[model samples]
Target: MRKQMIDSVSKVIAENENTSLFLVDIGVWGFRDVLKNYSERAINCGIFEDGMISIAAGMSLSGITPFIYGISPFILGRAYDQLKLDFCYQKLAGNFITTGAAYDFSKLGYSHYCPEDIELARTMPGLEFIAAGTPKEFEILFNSTWNDGNPTYYRLSNYCNKFDAKVAFGKAAVIKKGSKGVVIAVSTMLDSVIEACGDEDVTILYYTTLVPFDGITLRENLVNEKILLCEPHFEGALLPAIIDSVKDCAVKIKCVGVPRKINRNYGTKIEKDICFGLIDKDIRLEIRKFFNN
Candidate 1:
């Protein structure tokens, strides 16, 4: 996990001398001591989320590329205006490396939680969203989207666990083949989805990139037009993307994710998962009903 960030950030900065890295007060979790390796271009903006985003925008406008790192909620929710104008409006390029994705920080309460980040980021036009669920996905997508002219958000989780899953940028990977139905698992939720489907004859699709999603492949691979879409995000994060993919078909899609209600529930990630109906049994029930009915 550390190697992915260190190596990828080092390479991006090395290749682009005009780029800089910014951090909020929460750098310890995401960057660690490795950020000092790029001290020359580091901007530790303390806890001023909006200020840091505006400054990064200013820097980008002056022909400099800025890579901002911080918690997901603050980065996307707080500085949304600057993100919309400075980067999106000006058509400038910048990168956001965010942690505490979904409920990864649920124990920290709603202030630290980011269950709606994907839904919020989806509102911004032309922003590419990548959820590098596993370490391997991090290496490939982070490197692929680094230092581009377009704006991108790289949502992350604290889990350093590695998976053998090879995720294409926009295309969905079919982990298993099934004639019964298909399951679309987004990023980190792939593990739980795998466990939930255990030994069941069902097709599973994995996605990293949310925007510009390969809905074409998603539609083509639908065996029964019955999709059990799983995500560790809010209600409509990937719902629209899937809808766009299977618009023409009579696809019956049932999503398994956090509820679309007040998320006042606070606890550890596992507790929050259970509170939000993200357990394996819930997923299995959803899948069973989707395929059976």
Candidate 2:
């Protein structure tokens, strides 16, 4: 997936003279060698995330399209003020691509854990968020929205769904149709959601774009008043959208995601998943409980 982004962005930089790439120490390794050919446009900005956002905003003001790449927590969480004031508040356009979705770096502890990235991003008005579940999805979303002149957040994960469904900007794909309830899976949670819902009478919706929540398709495919939201990030991230979309109807929503609490443990992501009840068996149990109600 990193290769796909690097290759695609390299092509964009080579062709478009107004485009530039900024790396925040994390992407320096993979991007350093490729950026050698375009030394003037691409640069490693070290670990100054807040400063980097300001630089990208300035570049945007100068008519240069800046693509900033870094780890999830540092890029989004650490420099959030810069992102809000420089890019979002100023209405400037840039692409903020992040690696390490949620707890992908669980072994490294809470410094690298960022389950609230989506929640923070959605607060900034007009910002688009895309959680790419596969390399193909990232390539497609990047190509479609990179030059759209909106501040877009692309969350890349070390763990991705095995299959690549057709994805688009602000659109949800219906993976299955049923009459029991609706299961909306976001990014890396799709595979687990599918495995948990095997043969269940539920409609599955694969959601890649988080910010511009595709509620239209969700409303149109309502099989029941029950909704199960499977998100890779913090729980209730999509609750507002869910309620707004089904405003005319009375709906019941059950969310399975990272708990809204501080996690002090350090281990693999799977261990965290077990602790948070995000595993397939636990998800299945939750689904059954939801249905029984």
Candidate 3:
């Protein structure tokens, strides 16, 4: 998925003569490779995440659409002030491409894990948030954001599995059209939701865009069905938004996501799996409970 994102961004740069792609990288594992491959467009700022964000903001102010790439924890967590003040507050045309959403860096330990980036970014006004489940969906969202000229944050996982790119901006896609219930899984966890549904009467709503959420569609499809909102990050922005949006509906809404606890153990992929309840069996159990309740 990382390679695809880089390749897609490169294609966009090559094809769009007016737009220049500037990549800001921290000292993450694959930073050098991205820098080496896209030398002319990519910039290595060492470990200064906050500085990198500010630089991107400046570049955006100068009429260049900048795409800042970094680990989730550092890009969003470490550079919170810069992101809020420089990008969100100033309303720059910059795109934050966050890799390893949720527990993608589970093996790397807790400092490397970022489980609440979505919630954090959603709090800031004027910043658009998107979580893509597949390469195709990401392509659509990435290109659309550039055309839309919005301050956007895109969360991507390291690996790519084939998924339907039939997703629409500001709305969720129904992966499986079922009537038993609806499981609205945020980007990285869409596949798990599909598997957990099994033969049950469950519909999977892959929510790619969060900020300008598809309130019209949510109101249409989530009327009387049992609703479960799943995300890899901690429950905050999206969860509250879902609840508030559908508060008047007769649906039973439940949120499934990472527990709001600072992890003590060295963060690994396994730890992330545990944090988001991504284990197949565990997810299945949760789904069963949601239906039972």
Question: Which candidate number has the best TM-score?
Answer: 2
Task: Report the CA-based lDDT of candidate 1 relative to the real structure.
Answer: 0.80
Q: What is the lDDT of residue 193 in candidate 2?
A: 92
Clashing pairs in 1: none
TM-score preference between candidates 2 and 3, better one = 2
If the candidates were sorted by their TM-score against the true structure, best first, what order would they fall in?
Answer: 2, 1, 3
Q: Candidate 2: RMSD over Cα atoms? A: 1.1
Query: What TM-score, computed on C-alpha atoms, does each candidate reach?
Result: 0.92, 0.97, 0.87
* lDDT score at residue 209, model 1, on the 0-100 scale: 89
- Candidate 1 wrong stretches, greater than 4 Å: 28-38, 160-162
How much is the lDDT of residue 237 in candidate 1? 71
Model 2 Cα displacement at 242 (Å)?
1.1
**Model 3, range 8-59, lDDT digits (tens) per residue?**
7667656654444444444334455545655666666666889878887887
Among residues 3 or more apart in sequence or in different chains, the pairs in candidate 2 whose N, CA or C atoms overlap within 3 Å are none
Local distance difference test scores for all models? 0.80, 0.89, 0.74
lDDT value, residue 155 of candidate 2 = 90
Instruction: Check candidate 3 and list the clashing pairs.
Output: 106-268, 106-269, 107-268, 107-269, 109-267, 110-267
